[model samples]
Target: MKQTRKPPLAVVQISRAVTVIRFHVCLLFVFFASTILATLPSNVLFTSTAGSAVRMPINIIANQSFGYFTKPPQSDQIGLYVRDGDGRISDAMITPQSKYQNFLGVSRRQRTQGPEYAMIARLVGSWTDCNRGAESCVEDGFRLSAFEIKTPSPMPTICGDALITSETPTKWAYRDLVDYQYIVVAMAHVKVDCDSGVFAPDIQTRADGGE
Candidate 1:
């Protein structure tokens, strides 16, 4: 009988090396993909008191104003607002409140009577419709349940001019310098959903902080 010939040792070694390289490349891709998803807005299913699951929209405000101002000037007071699609501003309330409220209070105290400082925040909330024939009607009302805040560097264009100027005091509107919503949609490489009014981020750009 004829003896079977074996492949060269060098060729086998090269094949093993190639397989190992492919495995590592796959692992790297998975790691990066997961990282990006973590940074992007996740669709968290939040249940309302009525036992219905509601998907709240997570909005990124690149540069806006926040304050803890009240009539009595309480040390633990905080308030934030965001503009909705209808051009109406709504309250963006934070949960587990005291910690964040105190932070804002301290921040305000440190810069008392100075220019309003800018902030970047990611807010997760839902909008509630106003009741018909109510005593007071607020259009396009939103209530935020969760939020993350960061101080912006190289503030946005709208922030350049102080919200409250000596010439025209009593202004406390929160505005953005750029079209942040548009920017976020573009960065995510996703188009705006006209029906849902949501900007969905793609997997690759999800992890980016968008700073």
Candidate 2:
């Protein structure tokens, strides 16, 4: 009987390379598949509640709009206020306070105040706890400069029109110049769905410490 011939070195090497390539292709496919799942209803973003209550004063940055890495921070980032007895949080678009009405395109259409947030928030973010000033100051249970403050009622945390699920990440997320807490992902002005209406704020005093 004739002996079987062995495969050449080049053939073996080529086969190994093909195996490696296939492995990489499968890995990429898995990653993209997971990202697609994140976009679906399954993966929610900013779903967890923050529990740090550190007071930090913040200053509003520029009125101009700047892009983050590849995407933009949420301009006029409508925050989710504190949770209520019902375990709900309210999410509303920033009221279009038209100090720069012309910039906002349409005039003040929100209500008594301008828009809840600016069309584009560059570096400027005021404290939510301000009494009467361009800036506001707010104190809460969360100590971090920034926390996902839940609304008093249940509302959607949206990016553009679609809701942000837990899987959604801070892509090209921008932070306030003075404080890291005021971070946002800017999405140009778009129609918003305020579930109910803005909830009454929880009365809380500012922490005496924290510069």
Candidate 3:
């Protein structure tokens, strides 16, 4: 076979120019794509699980004290905080519109509308409005995010059993979970703004998840 000859210098130059053009085109495309992404509405919904158990066994005292303080929560269960929340609220209707001016989130100066921190309770079932403006007559809600032990297999405990076991940590905790519910045993400082909120994950709340 005859030996192959190299392309002419002009041909090589043209080839190099074509390659440079293609590279620039690609770079421009990436730049445009990134710019578009930045312009689009960004959703910052945060979700996470600590992969721990909630095992605070309550004695059968019918909500009666065991005459002794419950043991301090385990290391994994304590000092939980919601991450990434500035904990600011604005232009929201807070109940107890009374001395409510003194509420944490309410601005004493502004009185009604101010940077407020709200306590949002999650109810078990569909919540309905109560008559006579009764705030206490609403559906059963939780102050703390009730959590049960996370298990690989279905762990069943007696519904009638007043004693909380490692399997079922709460008196009635068999309901499906929802957003912002802390599944671990730790205490989390939930962070949010007036618009929306999420639990800042990977951080616990000794310092309100760094507030």
lDDT of 3 at 69: 51
List the global CA lDDT of all models.
Answer: 0.29, 0.33, 0.28
Per-residue CA lDDT of candidate 2, range 68-137, in tens?
Answer: 3225333333442333345343433344454464356465344422122322122123333322111122
Judge candidate 3 at residue 83 and give its lDDT. 16
Using Cα atoms with residue i matched to residue i, what is each candidate's TM-score against the true structure? 0.22, 0.22, 0.21
| lDDT: the better of candidates 1 and 2 | 2
Residue range with the least summed lDDT across 10 consecutive positions in model 3: 159-168
Model 3 regions lying over 4 Å from their true place: 43-211
TM-score of 2: 0.22
Worst 10 residues of 2 by lDDT: 50-59
RMSD of each: 22.7, 21.2, 23.6
Runs in model 2 deviating more than 4 A are 42-211
List, residue by residue over 107-166, the lDDT tens digit for candidate 1. Answer: 433332121221221111222233221112222122211122122322221111011101
lDDT at 189, model 2:
17
Instruction: Supply the global lDDT for candidate 2.
Output: 0.33
